[model samples]
Target: MTDFDTGIGDLAERLVTATRTGDHDYVADVLAKLAADDPRTRASALLRDLVDTGAGMIRARTREDNDALYTFDVTTEHDEPVHVDIVPPAPRAALRALAASLNRDAVDRDIHAVLATRGTPDEVVTVLVQCLLWTLELRDTRTPAVRLNCF
Candidate 1:
């Protein structure tokens, strides 16, 4: 089942509660809660983590110089084989888009149009990730790693 089953409102309530704790492990605990028995939920959480990490880098103005990129296998909507090789300094928009896709209200009308056009929520997320992946796939250099699985 997707987070639609779990309810985004409940997730937001938990997140608000977690942030109030001001503890470092709050994110991990919340992620564990979201990851319960659902691979897509875990994948969504992982993508959110990547976006958060990239936002941190943007805030710190840090640029990594390395050749190691993180890779993950993603089964396409059509059951085709694919992989994502992520590098450091992930795009802020990509991360925000992933997060917004979950909440349903934060993303623009275009994303909503996907669902209105008969696309499932899961498929919308997969398409978002794949679009971001395609941009990264064209990148020849690499630094750092971020992995998330969606199948």
Candidate 2:
């Protein structure tokens, strides 16, 4: 894996641990770090996109029951949002889906080709729509109280 992949994987692992223990503090710390570094300006941009797209502050849980799985609770700044299951780690199926998703004829193949080669977590998110897509799907399936929806 590339450095970006490694970093994201590590962060994902931390997220998982935090969830298993129900440690919101750890989740906040991770978010804060991402917010502080603002690597590739992804953290804030992602947050903005989430809010604009109707997603709210997300609380993620990396469950002990499954290694390749994660769950998120999307709550607003004041209201409780919803829970969304996610697999932050790149799995074969997700990759295949990602390859297909990025295969749109209207899209700039050159950009995604470069992004795939570069292999940064931020780039992966951009290319695969991983986090955002996963959040939306999981929320709908898992929670009924949530009113937010995005594609």
User: What's the lDDT for all of these models?
Assistant: 0.38, 0.38
Expressed as tens digits, the lDDT of each residue in 72-150 for candidate 2 is 3445456655343332322222332333332322133223333332344443444234444444454445443433332
lDDT of 1 by residue, 37-70 (tens): 3334443443443333333333233344344222
lDDT minimum window of 10 residues, candidate 1: 84-93
- Once model 1 is optimally superposed onto the true structure by TM-score, how far is the C-alpha of residue 42 displaced, in angstroms? 6.4
Candidate 1, RMSD to the unseen true structure:
12.9
**Model 1 misplaced stretches (Cα beyond 4 Å):** 1-6, 23-26, 33-38, 42-151
Clashes of each: 0, 4
TM-score of 1: 0.27
- Candidate 1 lDDT for residue 2: 48
